[model samples]
Target: MDFETSDKVKLLQEQIERFMVKYVYPAEAVAKQEIEASGDPHHEPKVMLDIRAKTRELGLWNLFLPDPEHGAGLTNLEYSPLCEIMGRSPLGARAFNCNAPDTGNMEIMAEFGTPEQKEKWLQPLLDGEIRSCFSMTEPEVSGADPTGLQTRAVRDGDEWVINGHKWFTSGAIGARFAIVMVVTDPDAAPHQRASQIIVPTDTPGFNLIRAISVMGSTHGGGHCEIRYDDCRVPVENLLGPEHGGFMIAQARLGPGRIHHCMRAIGMAERAFEIMCRYANTRVAFGGPIGEKQFVQEWIATSRMEIDQARLLTLYTAWKMDIYGKQVARQEISMIKVVVPNMLMNVLDRAIQCLGSLGISDDTPVAAMWREGRSLRIADGPDEVHKMVIARRELKRFA
Candidate 1:
């Protein structure tokens, strides 16, 4: 694959790096303090708003959507590197309006939403005026198996009533709306039995129960458990087709997984840098940890894994760009498994190398660890992706 980046992409990447150093990374501590003080997990600190404003002013906003009229109009391959640069800091994606749930939701709307739907929802989303969420996972059942979903949506007159319990509904607490999956026809084929409907967070029967923490941090816009007790939405809220939710979910998730991989690599790179810095500055016994053999080995290994993951992700992006998401499913699944696993290992080593400080938020390693670990379960989970890869290979051999 020709991985040569254009001058425009390179210049944008350099500009993003400068932006990260000057504003994004520095705002991390300030954002944390604001969240803690406000006692709101969804608190967008003023500093974050300023960064977002600056990002929008510089025309760096909504860089993830591939639609020219809606977003920056860059393809997946072009956006991949930009996303990786944003992934350097936890707040990076939000600064550019390129963060998760929102990105996937925006793509869905851009691709499938009707003109009115796009005008109402997609416009606000692209503008970053309001955030959104995806609710597909259930409190019960293996969420990885989309066919096993139990949330039900039934049509009643001009409205659709949704009933289900959903957890790990990422960004639900802060999201103004959600594109939710519900079974409209369970007797139909497993893959075609469900539908997607937009549920406003303020809908009468829809409930946001509480934020669920991963690795003990509830302030990082924690995953939420939500209940929809006959939550009714207008039939106009239906996205795509009646039994088309599963297909749309699949479409949304493929690119979504790539974005996750890109950001995870950036986080790992940051962790590796921190690990090396700590090794150089922290003296042990008579010399710096960098002088020690085992520490050097860890640093070396981190470099190797980071490089490998980045290459794999780039190849996946390239494949998607040239061959389309469906044709590149295997490569995408491969990185779906590789990127997080690589980052998890690198982060764990970095944590160990940092001693006790790494396990705490005193450094971003701890938060990075939490996020990277959760990724193993997010998207499709490692085992599921492995199954996809193995099946694809076995089919080819057969």
Candidate 2:
């Protein structure tokens, strides 16, 4: 897999590292103060705008997309390391306009949108002038099995009427629009029944129920609960082919899953650094905590696990580049199940090492821990990925 960083990626990686240190890490405190002062969890802080401007100026904008005209034109393998660097800070990805839901949404538009759709939505998103969300999960069904989705979209004259409920629509609070998945052909093949449509946030009958909190915290442009009560949009808003939502979704998630893993490796790396720093300097029982055998073991184990996970992620990315997403499904599923669990373990140990300080907001550890916990179920649960892996493996011997 050539496991080596190319000259191009190395230069980009160096720029990203410096930017995180000089801008993003420092802005964390400012962002928190702004969010607190506004009393809005979904508030877009001024500091974020400043950071976004700086990132665009530095030519770091749209690094996640592969389209040369819209993005940096880097392949999955080339983008992996840069993504990991962004993972270190919570605000890192957004600063460069490489954040989730947006990245995936942009990919869909670039790959499937009509010229008009691209002009209306994709351009502003690429310019960082707007944000977006993906609404697929529901309150009554397991999101892992999307074929069971209950949302309905019925054709009515020149517009389509959509009616359904969705939650965990991440980044919906202030988004300009949403890429919604709804059932267009209930009696068709299960996988072929759903279709994706774009609905503007301002459309009538489209209700923002609330910004649903995760682990008691509602992040900016929160994971939301939304209802489309006969919300209507022009037929031109339909994304991709009719009854092709499942295929489009899988394509969107393939790269999205790898990006999540890449960022997770960075998160784990940050936690390990925090744990080691705390253990080596903090005095306990007349000596540093590093003197304790268990603490030393934790440090060693964290280093080993982080390295292993990173390599696996890189290999999966390389495979995707060489063989395409379909051929790399097994590898993708492997990392999907592996990386988040590794992050959770590393975060737990870091929290333990920091003692009481870790659980508090004094450090990023607690928030990171919460994020890692949610990731286990976010893209797809661990069990579902595991099932994919097992079924693939079983096919070999059969």
Candidate 3:
């Protein structure tokens, strides 16, 4: 197990890190100001578009997708470190067009979309001309279990009419279309009961209720509430085979987890740096706070936790690259549970070290904490992943 990155990947790492320092970090405040000035919390910031053009100019775009034609064609292991750098600043992912919901959406579409779907929806998304969302989690169902999804789509002639209330339809507000997971056959097996359908946001019955505030902010393309009231789309809009929503969604989640965990590590690393910088410069007890045992312990523990999470995440990426996502299921579940919680631990310590400023939005640490709090619940909750990890372990013993 050689751990060295290839020269190509090493070059990408250097470019992305340099890009972060020069462009993304400075654009953070500009993004915030643009959003504020727009009078719409969910407005697409001008800085986002500016940096995207710059990122394209630098040949740093679409580093997430593994497809050679549309993306950088890098393997999962190669993409992991780059994603961590993008996760450091909140603006980082969009600047590189590697943002989520979009990344996962692009993956599934590139694999399953018909040629027309690719031309109409996928290309624009790939070119950064439009954004899209995934509509799976429903307001009425427990999000942890996708089997309990309640949305319904019934075939009527050439159209599939859809009806449901979905919240956390992430990125829905500005999306051009939604890849909707709906029940096509109620009596079919749980996994086969649903299918994914593409519905243009302008379709008559699709309603954007509002962006549900998380941790007191609804910035960017917010996590939106959408009611699909007898929404109709061409039957040809179905993605993949009939009853394939579960499979497609599962595929999206498997690799996407690696991206999420890496980004969490990046955020934690930034917070860790902020915490240590404060400890070195901020005097307490007639000396630097770094001299204190408690502060030192926080620093030491955070260092260990961050490195552990990164190694485990990178291992999971390597396993996915070497074997496949199915083969790496246990490790995937483990990191899905481990990394986000590890991030919270590191962020909590950093926040405590910085005291009031850590809780304030003046620094990115507080916002990272606010957003990272949801990581524990998103994708799959820790309890759910823990249950999965234990079941696989018990089966091994059995």
- Top-lDDT structure, candidate number: 2
Candidate 3, residue 251: the lDDT equals 90
Q: lDDT per model, in order?
A: 0.90, 0.94, 0.92
Using TM-score as the yardstick, the better of models 1 and 2 is: 2
Off by over 4 Å in 3: none
Task: Give a tens-digit lDDT track for model 1, residues 1-398.
Answer: 77898888888898899999999999999998988899777787889989999999999989887788888878788888899989989999999999998999999998889998898888998888988999999978898887899999999999999999999888887678999999999899999899999998999988889998776677545689999998989999999989999899988988999999999999998999999999999998999989999998999988999999999899888889888999999999999999999999999999999998888789999888888888999998899899989999999999
lDDT comparing candidate 3 with the true structure: 0.92
Clashing residue pairs, candidate 3? none
Please provide TM-scores, in order, for all candidate models, with all chains considered together.
0.98, 0.99, 0.99
Candidate 1 overall Cα lDDT vs. reference? Answer: 0.90
Q: Global lDDT for candidate 2?
A: 0.94
Please write out the lDDT profile of model 3 over residues 279-383, one tens digit for every residue. 999998899999999999999999999999999999999999899999999999999988999999999999999989889988999999888999999898999
Lowest summed lDDT across 10 adjacent residues in model 3 is found at 1-10
TM-score of 3: 0.99
TM-score of 1: 0.98
Return whichever of 1 and 3 wins on lDDT.
Answer: 3
